[model samples]
Target: MKWLKFKILILIILMLQVEAKADGIYFGGGFYSLSAEVGNKSTSLSNPSAYSLSYTKSFFPQISFEIGYSFLFESLIGGDMSYGPQIGVRYYHYGTSTNSTASLEGLSIHEVKSYNPYLSAGFSQKEFQSIKSSYSGFYLGGGVEMGWKKNLSLFSDFKYSQLSGPVQGKANELTIIVGIIYHDF
Candidate 1:
């Protein structure tokens, strides 16, 4: 009976000890580094470092909708290299703000006062010089968001980007990026 009472007290203490960060739409920009392989050859690109601007809006404290656009000089350009568009979802949890595996580890959501961890999944399409030889694919990734201030957040994402077979058998592009996110609306 004593043990049960103690357990309940501990649970309540933890619940009350959580902190509130931000839990709404997060729109911002950052740089991306992409690498991929083409048949027997492999390539990597850091500069001409493309720009990715995004909007992350949340309906609930745990879930949100995200829309973003980015431009890059794909590792290998069979024809023309250009930027692409991406659309997807982002789910966040502020209960784990100190985790190193967070997507937005350096950002904060001031809607509540608790954990600061999150996961995101999205898709992107890469347009090349030739329509018949384009590259596009979907990805699933997750991480946490930490608060540097009230509006600044440092984030990292690991994406597995593959080329669509409809666009021909092109090499696959899997990328990971770490950048800053600033909240606007």
Candidate 2:
């Protein structure tokens, strides 16, 4: 009986410790622009607008995994619209004197203001006429998140991707994104 009680006490203590840690799920949406070049020809597509939705799971205060989907209103290659899913891991770094507290829905929350830099690799497929082309590549970028409230923030980032596939030569792309994030603690 004493051993069972001791085990129960240990479990309760561990739960309390976990509750004190900062870990949560986050959802975000934003707008993006993509520019691409294939071979010696740059796509004539202008500043096309795209939308993205993402979900992130933070296992630690500074590290998280994110998965998201993006849909372009117009194709960078010109004929039809394109869309794809992406997954990546991100790391967050806080500034020395950046900390704040706010009340959201009557709950007090804490956050840090800083920059987050990340590297990601993904694959996407676009169809032109009846021909389907696939692209796979990696991108590196960094961004800043400014906390608006305890659970909400605004952010922006830029990424450069180098892709190769059935194209005449390597296709290079530059993307810019601006968005808002909501955290569920």
Return the top candidate by lDDT.
1
| Alpha carbon deviation, residue 153, candidate 2 (Å) | 1.3
C-alpha local distance difference test of each model: 0.54, 0.53
Alpha carbon lDDT at 30, candidate 2 = 40
Taking all chains together, the TM-score of candidate 1 against the true structure is: 0.58
Q: Mind giving the per-residue lDDT tens digits that candidate 2 earns over 118-147?
A: 444444333222235666566666566555
Worst 10 residues of 1 by lDDT: 96-105
Off by over 4 Å in 2: 1-44, 75-79, 95-109, 112-131, 167-169
Quality of model 2 by C-alpha lDDT? 0.53
Output the lDDT of residue 29, model 1.
33
